[model samples]
Target: MSLKIAVCIKPVPDPDYYDQITIDPVRKTITRAGIPTIINPVDKNALEAALQIKEQVGGTVTVITMAPPNGEESLREMLAMGADEACLLTDRAFGGADTLATSYTLAQGLKKLGNFDLVFTGTESADGATSQVPSQLAEWLGMAHLWNVSEIKLKEDQAEDKVQELQAKMKIENGYIEYEVKLPAVLAVSRDLNTPRFTSIMGVMKAKKKPLTVFTVNDVDVDRTLIGLDGSPTKAGAVFTPSLSRKGERLTGDLDEVVEQLLQKLRAAGINLEIKSSSQGGR
Candidate 1:
C-alpha cells in the first residue's frame, strides 16, 4: 500500500514587485498583469513535508494548483523540487474565487486525481492570507484537517509502504499541541515544518520530461454553479491603500520631563506603562 500524497500549491505575485501590485477598482481584485509570479513561500514548506514523507515511505508526491495557465511555471518548479507529478487546474471560470469557491474547485481537482493517503497545503497564500482554504477544502472533501502544523512524523510500527498514522504538532497561541492524526486527512503546514530542498540542475532538466497535466472546468466533475466568482458568495467591499504617514510631536523639556511627557503620550494612546522602584523588581 504505497502512500499517495498530494501537495496543494499556489502561484502568487512575486514579493519583489509588491509595490507594483494594484487593485482593480472594478473587479476589486489584485491586478496581477505585468507582474511576475512565484510559488507562495510557505507552500514550499508544505511541498517539502510531502517530499520528505515520500522519501521516508514508499510513495508518490503530486503537486496541485489552481491558477491561470501561467501557473504551469509554478508546477514545473514543484516538479524540479522532486514532486513525482503535477496538475494544473486553470480556466477563466476560476477567476474571482473566494476561499469557498477556491477550495471547492481544488476539492473537485483532488476528486479527479483519485484518492490519496494525505493532502498537504500551506496555512495560507501570500496574496490572500485569509487562512481559510485548508479547513474549507477539508469540509468540501469530508475529511479531517489541521492547520498551522509545525511538525509531522510517522507513527512507529507502521507497515512498510503504507502510512496509517502521523504524529503532528499544531502551533497554538503561546505553545504547540501535538496529535496522533489518523491517515487519509489534510494538513496545512506552517513555515517551520521544514526547509524546502533546493532544485538541482539535473532535476530542473528532468522536470521538463515529467508528467504535467492540465485540467479545466470541463475536465473535472464539478457543479458549474459551485466554482468561480458566481459560486463565491462573498465579494470584496472595497480596495484602497492605507496611509502609512504618522504625525510626530516635539517635546521641549529637560531629560526627565521629556521622559515623563513621552510616557504620558504613550498612555494617552491607550498603551499601559508600568514602572517599579529597584526594590520592587525594577532593574
Candidate 2:
C-alpha cells in the first residue's frame, strides 16, 4: 500500500515590496482587491514537504482547505503543483470563523475524506498569524501533533511490517531537536523546511483534467449547528490600528558629559537610573 498524505493550504495576499494589506471592517473580511494572491508561504512549504514524502514513499498527495467557493482557485493551484486530488469545504455557515471554528470545519472535511497516513499544515497564516488552527485540528481529530518542523525524514519500518516511522528535526531557540514519531500524525511545517516548486506548464494542463472534490457542512456529516458563526466559540470583537508617537533627542559631547546629560534627562523624565562605579571605569 502507498502512503496517503493530506496537506491543508491557504491563500494569502501576495507580499509586495511595500508589504501592505487591506481589510474590510464592515464585512469582517480582507479585501484582496488589486492585491495579487498566492499560496500562503508556510503552507507552500508544507505542500513541499508533502510532495517530498510522496516522491520518496510512493503515495498520493491530497490538498484541502476551508474557504468561500471562490477559494477553489487556491485548490486549483495546489493541483497544478502535483497534488493528486483537492477538496474545498465552503459554506455560508463557515463564514466569520475564528481559528477554533475554522479547525472544526476542516476536521469535518478531513473526516469525510477518509483514511490518511499523515496531515500537513503551515505553522501560521500570513494574515491572521494566530498559529492556533493546526494544533486545534490535531486536538479535534485526536492525532499526534508536531509544530515548526524544519526538516523531516521518513524511515520505513520493515520490521514492524505495518507501520512507518518519521524522524523530524525541528529548530528550537537553543538548537535543533529530533522527534521519532509514528505515522498517521499531523505536522505543521515551518517556512525553513523546504522550497516549494513552481507549477509546471504540463502540470497545469494536467490539473485541468484532474478531479477536484467539493464538500459542504452537510456532506461531511457534521451538525449544521456545529458549523459556521453560531457554532463558533470565539468572536471578532473589534479591530483598530494603534497610533504611534516619535520624539527623541540626540546628544553629542565628551563621554563623561554625555553620560551626565543622559542621567539628567532620565531624572527629568522621572525614570529611575541605577548607577554603579567600578574601579576600571575611568581607566
Candidate 3:
C-alpha cells in the first residue's frame, strides 16, 4: 500500500548570517529582517527519511512549514528534495510563537492537508532548538509520538493498507530504546537517521511544476487564543547575541609555573577542580 507522508520543515536563519539575526524585544521573537534561511539541518534528515520510504513503496511526500512568506524559497528547495507538494503556513498572527503556538499552527496546517498516514519532523529546529514541537504537535493532532529516533523500520499490512506501522530505535541517555508505534504516528528524528539527498537540476525543474500551496491564519481552522504571541505560554526572558568574548592571559614561565598560574586563574574564575589519581575526578 502507498503512504502519504508529511514532513514538517523549518526555515531557520542561515548559519552564514547568524550574526545578522536580531530580536524584537517587545514581541519576544527573533527578528529575521535581514537574515536568510535554510532548511533546518535535522529537518532535512526528516525529509530524507520520508523520501526513502516513498522510494521503497509507491507513495507521496509532502513538506510543510510555518514561517514568513520568505520561507517560500526554502519550501521550493524542499520540493526539489523530492516532495510531491509543499505548503507554507504564514501570517502576522503566527509571530512570536513559542513551541506551543508553533505546534498548534502546524497542526492546523496539517489538518488542512487532509489525512496523512505518517508525519515526520526534526527532533528540534536549528534556530529554536526547543525540541518541543513534535510532541506538542502529536498532542494537538492526537497521535502517538517519539523523539530522537535514529532508525525506522516498517511492518507492511496486506490488502492495500492505508497506514504502515513502524518499529523504531530511539537514542536515550545511557543507550537506546525500541518501540513499535501504530499507524498515523508523529516521529521526530535526529540527523543520525539518514543522509539527505542533494537537490538535482531535474528536481529543480520538476519542483517548479509541483504545487506549492500557501495558507494564512484565517485559512486553517485554529483557535485565535492558542496560536501566536498571545497564545504562547513560554515568554522569552532575554534575547541577545551570545557573547563569545574570551579573555586571553599569558603565563610567562616554565611548564610547572604556567600550570600553577592556570590553576590560580581557574580558581579565581570560580571553577573547582579535584584531581584524582588513576581514577574518576570531577567538580
Best by lDDT: 1
Give the alpha carbon lDDT tens digit for every residue of 1-283 in model 2: 4788999988777766223555577876545577777778889889889998888768889999988787799989889989999999987878878787788888878888887789999999887889898899888778887888898988776766444778997688878889998878899998899988998999999999888999876678777666778778887776654456667668889999999998898899988655645654777
Candidate closer to the true structure by lDDT (higher is better), 1 or 3? 1
216-271 per-residue lDDT for model 1 (tens digits): 98899999898899999997776787777888768988999999998899999988
**TM-score of each candidate structure, all chains considered together:** 0.86, 0.82, 0.84
- Which regions of candidate 2 are displaced past 4 Å? 17-19, 22-32, 160-163, 245-283
lDDT-sorted candidate list, best first: 1, 3, 2
Q: Rate the local accuracy (lDDT) of all candidates.
A: 0.90, 0.83, 0.89
lDDT (tens digit, per residue) of candidate 3 on 1-283: 7888999999887777767777777776777786766789899999999999888777889999999999999899999888999999999999989999999999999999988888999998777688999999999999989999999998877676644578998999888899999978899998889999999999999999999999998899999999889999988786666678898766899999989998998989988786545455434
The candidates, ranked best first by TM-score, are 1, 3, 2
The better-scoring model by lDDT among 1 and 2 is 1
TM-score of 2: 0.82
Residue 62, model 1: lDDT of 95
**TM value for model 3:** 0.84
At residue 211, what lDDT does model 3 achieve? 97
